[model samples]
Target: MSALQIFVLALVQGITEFLPISSSAHLVLVPVLFGWADQGPLMDVAVHTGTLLAVLVYFRKDTVGLLLAALGSIGIVPARRAVAGSVYGKLFWALVIATLPVVIAGFWLSASGLHAVLRSPQIIAGTSILFGVLLWLADRYGPRVKALDAMALKPALLIGLAQILALIPGTSRAGITMTAGLALGFGRQEAARFSMLLAIPTLIAAGTLAGAEIAASEDTMLWRDALTGAGLSFLAALGAIHGLMRWLSHAGMTPFVLYRIALGLVLIIFFWTGSS
Candidate 1:
């Protein structure tokens, strides 16, 4: 990949990974729209690793608390009452439970090869528009009384189930999970925060699988590209995450919702015209 291609793809991954816009869709569309070759699994893993690092660093405090709490839960270390009783403890469990649905769904999709089959532009266009509308409805009418601390098993499971829909190209993981959070009454920032936290495990699982593939292939060019993509994506993702959290407090999801809808419609039109 050229430097420009690397930069552009990295930027897209970083920005869209955390945003309600589907990063996978953008990744797919970018190559198609620009006539660039597919980024391949190695590059995909690299950028994902970068974003994973960004979220881990951005939420380091929370990550540590959750880690300690997790250890306590398993009796790896002595259980601290304070840790056990804290929001972090509950959040740790919530994240674990929320992660299960996607893990199972991803396995099934991969095993069935449905993940590859659903990567068409038409699928992306339909899902992008459909979920964008769902996001708008949830944001507009859903109650906003709940905070992340209020996350419970049932709601977290619901959000996880929503995340399974994200396996479809345009049904964004962040978007669908946030929609679930909003519908469950979480404030915008709270919903965004949990969605991000939830991404930790999901990204890790994906990156690991991608890493294994890269190791087996031993592609030197892919390694170089992956390294470049990872560094650039990390920087971009950090900025995106910070900006998003700040913006959500003052402005809601309107801008992102509009963007998703517009992008989807454009894709639909482009594909329809080309086919005709």
Candidate 2:
């Protein structure tokens, strides 16, 4: 990829990763659009790292608290195993545990030759539209559950399970998880916040996987591009997260729903025209 392509993909990664817009979809589509996606593992690493750092910085205090709590809670005890061992610790570990589904699935797919779907534009478009509609309905008619203080284990678990859908490229992580949270009685803003919190571990795992692969790569020039992309993504991701929270807190999911629908339709149109 050229410097311009790296830069644009970085911008897209930052902007799309946090929003209910699918970053993976954009990473694929945007590169395809500009014909810039001769992307290597390093480029993927850059995107993942940028988004990961964004979450880490945004939630630094929360991560610190969780680490402290988890460290303190560590001991040979069965009761505590069900718990993070403390408030922050439990939530942190819950996020980690919840991330297991995606990790297992992603790693499995990596090893099992199922990663081919990552390149499928049709699957991406279909998932984008389907989940887009689901998000719209979720915002429109969800039960509007209470906040985290009132949250129970079952609801959290269910939401985590729902997040598993995001392993598909077009299923936005934020969109699906928040929709699941809303289904379980979380208010829009609360659901949104929980979804962001959930991003912590997921990003960490993604970064780790992408990072490992990138580290093993032989191309230094791609690493330079990856670094540049990571930097841009980090910068953009912060603003994206802030804006998404602010919008969802007061406005709900209408903006994201409309955006998704528009994007999906445009993709479909592009495909139709090309085929003809």
Task: Please tell me which predicted candidate would have the highest TM-score against the true structure.
Answer: 1
Clashing pairs in 2: 84-90, 145-185, 145-186
Which candidate leads in lDDT? 1
Model 1, span 1-276: residue lDDT tens: 888888899999999999999999999888898999987766877898899999999999888888888888887655545486689888988999999999899899999998888988999998999999999999999898998889999999999999999999999999999999999999999999999999999788878877777678767877778878989999999999999999999888889899998988998889977798
Cα TM-score per model = 0.95, 0.88
Angstrom error of the Cα, residue 9, model 1: value is 1.2
Candidate 2 structure quality by residue, lDDT tens digits, 186-219? 7887787778778877667667776676689888
lDDT of 1 at 169: 92
Deviation from native of the Cα of residue 174 in model 1, angstroms: 0.4
Off by over 4 Å in 1: 78-82, 213-218
lDDT of 2 at 75: 64
